[model samples]
Target: MEEKQMDLVSLLLRPELPNVQKELPTARYRVKRLSELLDTDVVFTLKGLPYGKVQKLRESMSDDVSVQILLQGCVEPNLKDPVLKEHYGGATPAETVKAMLLPGEIEDLSRAVERLCGYRKLTIEEVKNA
Candidate 1:
């Protein structure tokens, strides 16, 4: 009986692509798993991270400030990164407002989060930054 149930669960969990309406001729971004979005085998988890850091990210996600907060929380030696260190040195939330222009592959960060949010299905949302 357990084996039968396991088989049924596996079938139900398979990934399926949804019918997405493309706004333009160009393809639209689709939510993929975090592992897939990074194009590497690494699996990032938020386990054991500080709640304050995560909350700060959620609050400021609409802005680029969340990126550094995220990196500081999960990615080790985050402040050591020269690029981040130079731009964000003594960085405050207000300072981040003007830093990291052309955040190369900003899409990746957004998409990855979207994908993580939609682990069971591909759910995508686009927000224009003014």
Candidate 2:
């Protein structure tokens, strides 16, 4: 995984020391609930295809793609019902995942590391000169 993504995963797994216990449970619960919500069934319509053919088409897609299409299909239904909209947050499951990872949710740990290292390196060079 990319460094940024890894950092995000680390942050999700374990936030800063003081908040770790509280944040961990909330994060785990949110991830589990979102996953279950995303796993619900979706019907697909294949052009000019009979039932069996459509089933085959659905089977051909990767799990990720299938879930994406399923969530997209739910948009209209969700829009029509307030409860569904509230549950879905006015966005698809994929979108919900993206929202959770936005800057608001996790610290910029990678950048923080880089800045600390840079400062340390500079201080070392200054000490050597002195």
Candidate 3:
């Protein structure tokens, strides 16, 4: 019989305050990629000799992309819809994201990017510094 050594401890998992002194300066802005949004099921015409059809199709398509939008704390309810109609012209949010959407106001770019990326937001101070 082999004896097993166990090292067990209990901990109260809680959020910790960041130590500003040890952390990076406030000028740094966290960046994220554009693909973090909706998941897509891309269909590609792969070239293979299975049943030996003609050459595979050269196009790729994906119509099954799932999206979950959380407008709260993001969009200003009072903001006129005409603003959206101006640039996007009723295009789907996914399309707007693919197009690297920017807000009408320069000051709102961070909020716009945050909504678009759905993960992080930039700061105006950091933007100006950069």
Please tell me which predicted candidate would have the highest lDDT against the true structure: 1
lDDT of 3 at 123: 32
lDDT of 2: 0.36
Better of 1 and 3 by TM-score: 1
* Residue-by-residue lDDT tens digits, candidate 2, 42-73: 32211122234335545775553333332322
> Which ten contiguous residues of candidate 2 have the minimum total lDDT?
20-29
Best by TM-score: 1
Model 1 ranges with Cα > 4 A deviation: 1-56, 59-83, 87-104, 119-130
Clashes of each: 0, 0, 0
C-alpha RMSD values across all candidates: 14.1, 18.9, 19.0
Off by over 4 Å in 3: 1-9, 12-82, 101-130
lDDT of 3 by residue, 69-107 (tens): 212112332123445545765465444432343332222
lDDT of 1 at 4: 84
Model 2 misplaced regions, further than 4 Å:
1-57, 76-130
In the range 31-97, model 1's lDDT, one tens digit per residue, is 2442366785443332123445445666767666435543543332233456654676535533442
Q: What is the lDDT ranking, best to worst?
A: 1, 2, 3
TM-score of each: 0.29, 0.18, 0.21
